[model samples]
Target: MDNASAITVFTLSGLNGTEKYRIPLFVVTFLCYSLIWVANVIIIVTIIMDKNLHEPMYILLCNLCISGLFGTAGFYPKFLSDLLSSTHVISFPGCLLQGFVVHAYIGVDFSILLIMSLDRYVAICRPLVYHSVMTRQRVGLLVLYAWLLPATLVMVGSITTFILKLCDSHIPRLYCINYFVNKLACTASVANFIIPACTYTIYVCHFVIIFWSYFYLIRTCRQSKEKMSKFMQTCLPHLFCLKILGVSLLFDLMYIRFGSVDLPQGLQNFIAIEFLVVPPILNPVIYGMKLTQVRNRIAQLFGKRDPMPHKAEFLMVEFESSCPNPPQDPFEGTQHRHEGVSLNQDIIQAFSAAACLASGSRHGLIRLGGASSGSHTLFRHGEAVFKLKQQVSELLLF
Candidate 1:
């Protein structure tokens, strides 16, 4: 089918004729839709307020929440309108617009997920370089690409679908997605099937690469005990999210290529909620609860701080006549040590003695060791008591 014969509008056969089902369906759909929206909103607000969540993982999560909002917003309003109003009709342009926005956001969401996986891979795989590689500036640029690239792709796909002529007017689902909506068109090109298939394949390949990167990251982290525990804590939530998204995609693939099995649809629809909603909801919880920095911020936000233990302090009293050159066994020697002092004790005695010795004044040159080879001289300004300690120490030796 060429561009001229393509059908612009599609008539949805989903609960359109039922008078009794409309109000109940509206309430149920409205609640589900509202739940997704409210949950996403909470995540976005939490990320913005929590200083601990300023990192790339949390930023990616915020983006995903925004994308999910766009997805739900694009699909539900029109769905609500169709359900409530006497007219179940959508103009060709309106239907096309809806399709574009929905697919575009889905694409953007996928790209953001890829970026998140890469963020985790770098954090675990290259710990030293992770900050340099995924800095704020670099993250901002990646996010721009995540949104923009999908928008371009959406334009191409939406145009292709809009231009194809429809043989029948009835669209099967409550929502107009790519496959079912496209099936209504009269022009079924290998291009139509091939292009979408290739697009999905590209996304699938992206998903595969992220998992492969994470696999290597996990393997590398296991070699070191310190990093191993932190690595598991950091990567677990992302792994769960990836699993949910994988199942959603799997069902989508099967639904499109194979015959529409009842099992796949049920699983797909259920997993779809997880794919879009769970990541956003879990992101703040995981990052906020597990990380020290985030927890500190949370405390700070609540105007609280952890109590610090008091430390006991004392003075050092013993000293040696001859100061050793190498300071023998600093930790073990007790000759110049305050044996009973706790580690936190301040070295007050030495400072006090030095202060007292430097307080008075004098001015003279004094020699020690009786001018022998080892003799040392001390200069006192008519009253530079700072040199008194040296003179007194030399006299003590003599």
Candidate 2:
């Protein structure tokens, strides 16, 4: 209590007694941080630049990567610098800010993953209404909720922690946490305990809601093989991401309460920073490798394309146009009419093209294609087809 007024900086004793390994640790940390930035930046930029990827699902993923970047930025820079220096100290405000960013990042991860699962549910269980329900405005709003809710909770919690009058200036971990900071309080209050409990309870409810939604998602997928493939393609990555987050955060929480000095220092350090290191790197990689559209786009960027068969290509073999005066030739555009239904000329242009980006209908991707391209013109809306060939090498559809 007597030292409460004199402290301006806190010592991070996590780096204690590891002086000899500092350079090696710094190198590894730097590379890890660089990989985090590269992986995340690739995802963010790829989603933003590719118009084919502008769907609700991809948009949500972009935000996920953004949040990954947000959270890791708070830890890695400081940790890297600390690894190289004999004295690992942080100013009062810096400690709080780091805590705020890291915690908010965790909050955002929980909210976004839940939002993503709901998105998967709607897409798998209610394909027809997916677009209508996940409208641009609604998606924007959902994303807003994902970000604002956690940020608000974390800010309030940070404020609560900030008001504490601490008697000690040493944090044993590599970073600051409101929980530990509160432990240094000259005195304790009911609000401190109440607020943290409430915050954690809310996040727990988020997990509950997500699991329930996935319960239904799994059930609906079992009804058909197509549905099952969709579930495996899209939902698996989300589950993996959720698992990464759960395990890392859970270990850290357990360590906070039950950590024993008998544990190896390396093990303790890993537990404390697992969330900071693992999730940021794996989230982007998992989504990239799992999702069809994202994976194809990334491959395309690197001048490689994966072969995928498309269902839409078979339907495009022949289309009847009710143009007032339709061209008899499929290759050359003309006006014709049949059954009083008119097909737009754009269909001919779209069907005639061969190399398409393959993110065709907002409704869904093309899933079936082994039938060769035939001499028929169809009014495909969003696909580009220059099909004068007897066979399509392969149609890539997201």
Candidate 3:
């Protein structure tokens, strides 16, 4: 294309050397995209359905997963289509839209991570006032800003790219990025450089805030065992997520800006697409396993019940055997009162045995069970057992 005004469609040159591997790549990409959708959807649904998980941490996690879904949607579907087609092309407007979505997705991720760090800082450092500080209204506003800020900034960047006069209509990547798109322009504009620089500066501030929060978190945790445990349980997962995303993004940025033909084609492709491949799938898996409540809720959702002791079952069986029939009125006759007392003693003995068994203490089981058994035997044949039965029935009524 001679000029941006004359360009209607842009040809993608990223797939030029990978034609032989397209089928295998298509299969792998399909599986990856499927996994991203399923994992993120599972987390989003789990958080929404479980009211007990409606705290700031889980709410932020849901937003993160939603961002993953949003970001991956921009690349995967179109990339899959390109894999099967001989000609890889996108319209001028389509490329701009894809660029906007992809960039906005990245911006939303950084923004959400920033908010999450702030939440953790307030929760761990200002625990006493966490509730007052992270109210429902405030979290809602923060989430709204997380999405809106990125969309607005990225939109401006996309518009700047859209107006640039281009000398080429060939993009070397499987997907669109504003940075890559700007490189095709015939002439550099001040707005192009200035807007992207400002965007990077804003996200760099996000990184600084995240690291600053972590520093305080580390210091607070070192002073107390309880705080340390909380930090490990919660903050470690966030840190892991930040590390994966940061490294992936770094690889992509470096590869796009300074990649060389000397590097292996496969290696360059891997570096270029690492961000889209790793974070979407890994984030949900990491959070699902590390967050105790989320893990337990997931287990419960899939009908995996916690293990119960066999001893409790044994105790129930013994109690049922001893009390074959429901108790009759103890006041009806002398024989009835005697039988009721005997049954009541067996029930108490059974309960005491179960308690000892559940505790899994051999010493306590021997002592408590032996005492209860002997006491039941002594009371079973005693003349005063009927009077004890009357008192027990009155207690049960009360």
Task: By lDDT, rank the candidates, best first.
Answer: 2, 3, 1
Q: Show where candidate 2 strays beyond 4 Å.
A: 307-317, 321-398
- Against the unseen true structure, what C-alpha lDDT does each candidate score? 0.60, 0.75, 0.74
lDDT for residue 212 in candidate 3, whole number 0-100: 96
- What is the alpha-carbon lDDT for the whole of candidate 3? 0.74
Give the alpha carbon lDDT tens digit for every residue of 230-318 in model 3.
Answer: 78878888999899999999988877777786887678778877888898899999999988668877888899853531110111112
lDDT of 1 at 381: 35
Task: State the lDDT of candidate 1 residue by residue for 234-325, as single tens digits.
Answer: 66766665666567656555655674535444344444344344444454556456644445555655687644211111122332222122
- For candidate 2, give the lDDT: 0.75
Which scores higher on lDDT, 1 or 3? 3
Best candidate, TM-score-wise? 2
Q: Arrange candidates by TM-score, descending.
A: 2, 3, 1
List, in order, the clash count of every candidate structure: 11, 19, 0
Evaluate model 2: give its TM-score: 0.81
Q: What is the TM-score of each candidate against the true structure?
A: 0.66, 0.81, 0.76
Give the lDDT of residue 93 in candidate 1: 77
